[model samples]
Target: MSKRLLARVAALTTGAALAAGAVVAVASPALAAPLGTVNLSQTSGLVTDSPMFASAVTSAPCPTGFGEESALRIGPAETGPFTNLTPSLGGGGYDKAPVTANPNRSFQLALGSAPANGRWWVVVECFSLLEGRHPDRFVTEIVVAGNQWRVPVVEATTTSLAVSPASPVEAGTPVTLTATVAPSGAAGTVEFLRGTNSLGTAAVSGGTATLTTSTIPAGSWSLTARFTPADPGSFGASTSAAASLVVNGPAGGVSKVETITADVDPGAFTLDVAQPPAVELLGGQVGGTATGALKQATITDLRGTNAGWDVTGQLTDFTGAGNIPAGNLTWTPSAAKASGSGAVSAGTPANLGDTRTLCSSAAGSSAGTFTCDAGLSLSIPDSVPPGAYTATLTLTLV
Candidate 1:
């Protein structure tokens, strides 16, 4: 071995050792820093009537010497530049340190006030293991999550009305009008109106509002209830269906008669004759005679001299068996009398088809009482079925 050979061999061995070290370093994997990710509790499609809440969670524990940083922001749908909210993370401010017991940091955001009705988005950003006064470097590693929230407006309430002494009430009589609002929890006032004329206003209590009035005139009137919401912005107003009211004039002299009235009594009959049993035929003919006693109509006339009165009667056909023929029934007024200085005229025999005058008085008359008596004869055909029969008799006086 020579000196030149020894030097060359030493240099070559050193170079080979350096090359092997470089290859080993290139095969080794690089080191990665701790990363953070945010997961929102509500991703989207959240509807709220009042306040809402959301939570953000991190993927891993915060880095050493750095606390968790979080913020909440909200904006209209499809819009940018969201507005940040002051959130209470882990029951404290954003700058507060996270609890060590829970490795995955969790923060809660409360939306105390709801925005206007429509679509909106809630965005949350959480930075884990952040440090320094100016933490721009940590911001790039921040985790963000967003969700769509909806705050719908309250629906309008419904209203209903009821009027006492429904119809044909005497004028000057006290009448009560009640208005009820649906959704019992509704708070508002109701205005009573009579065909666009304000009657009065009443506050709703226990879902009902009432108003009393005695000044309604004598005529047909339509009453309505209009509701006014206390918070127009929150709840809408509504109106109720109209209620009909009919008022009558006071009882007094119209022209000459101070007062005139009449009373009518219905006629009844029971066909139970042993000798001739009544049998209804299919042709609408009666086998035996079925006679009904006469009905009475009494009239009280209070008038001066030269006063006259007339009475007319209208009869309805038997309703059984699809309306029994009207001509089958006939009416006759047998007895008629007048208590005053007027003669009472008897009524002619007439069928139930047309109007018939049953009684009349002379032109000259005074305060007196009049009485009328009538009888009914029924002729049922064979065609009429066997069933109960009914008819109505109407009496009018003038």
Candidate 2:
């Protein structure tokens, strides 16, 4: 990004330099022979290759901030008829002068309409460097034609977009969605939609688009406006991608936290602990009164809508009073509050029933009713020994 100055000039063969503050005067014969036909030739400036979106050096900055750089010059081509000249700036064919800041320093020309994303060049005055002569003011001869090239866009581009937990989703749970756009301009907006209902819109700088739903009502939805052009006529048209999202269930409604179970080996029994259940630990006597243990649970996926779902669970040590109970002691209920941070396809937590639990048991008997000192609490059970246990909990998300 250099500084620039543009000066417009015309030839006045016999014009004399002006005095300190007086205007210069041109000498002309009152009745000189009729002038010859004034012919104009088509000419172009110099061309250079540069990266896409890269700025071109127009005029060099002045050393002491003294001299100025003028705008592009109009001239005839080498072998064409001479014609009138018109000044254009910024490559838009707009009749405007080149802007400048420092008098004799460098300046830049903005490269526009360059399709690709790479190198370009700037047209500058032609000057000669020789010994002893400063060229007075670095006088340059302007060449016509050859002044435009392409530069890099310095941005990202995407071919399409995708939504998690595909359409027809349940309400309440969060549904995470993402979009892809190509040639992501400097900056723009990506809009989300539910059949034109504008779920919401997000700002994308590079080439990514993200949107989250607040447990939308069960129905179909779509994503749009993945990409936009920097300026109209930019590349001639606009581009975008699309995706679908469906939501199910009621709006703003709450139901009892569902329970989970597991299907495993007959002897090894699989305890389903998807989401935490109302009764984390359940145990009854196969003979002598059976007792419960430290109980706690963290509920989730009440209705199957959490796009990103996860939970944590833990149970305390179990103690046997004596010996008398039979029927191969079994822990009826499992802990369902244990889970790690995780992600689901695409669907709101409110609309998905995704949860887990943990459970442990030991055979014993011979004593008063089995009593668990530490009752059900959110905290991990302390009576449970340190050991890892995995269980499966089945839940309904309707």
Stretches of candidate 1 off by over 4 Å are 1-152, 253-398
**Which candidate number maximizes lDDT?**
1
* TM-score of every candidate relative to the true structure: 0.31, 0.26
Worst 10 residues of 1 by lDDT: 14-23
Question: How do the residues 1-398 of candidate 1 rate in per-residue lDDT, one tens digit apiece?
Answer: 10000000111010000000001111111111213334444433423411233444445433332245555445554443444544423432333332212112122233334445444444443343311211211111111233334233466899999999778799999999999998777788999999999999999898899999999888889999999988664467989999999988878825333677888643221111121212121112233223343435666565444466677766566664445555655555643444655566656556657777777777764246667654444555656444445555556777
Regions of candidate 2 where Cα sits further than 4 Å from its true position: 1-159, 184-186, 231-241, 251-398
Determine the C-alpha RMSD for candidate 2 after optimal superposition of all C-alphas.
36.6
Instruction: Tell me how far candidate 1 lies from the true structure as C-alpha RMSD in angstroms.
Output: 42.9
What digit string (tens of lDDT, one per residue) describes model 2 on residues 1-398? Answer: 21111111111000001011112121211211111111112112223332212222333332111123223221222221211122322222111222221111111222222122222222222211211111111112222223432222233344466777766666777877676656655356666666566777777656677887775765565555535545322322233555665667686755565789986532211122212222322222122111222222223332222232222222222222222111112221222222323222211101011221221221221111111111211112324332222222222121
Deviation (Å) of 91 in candidate 2: 28
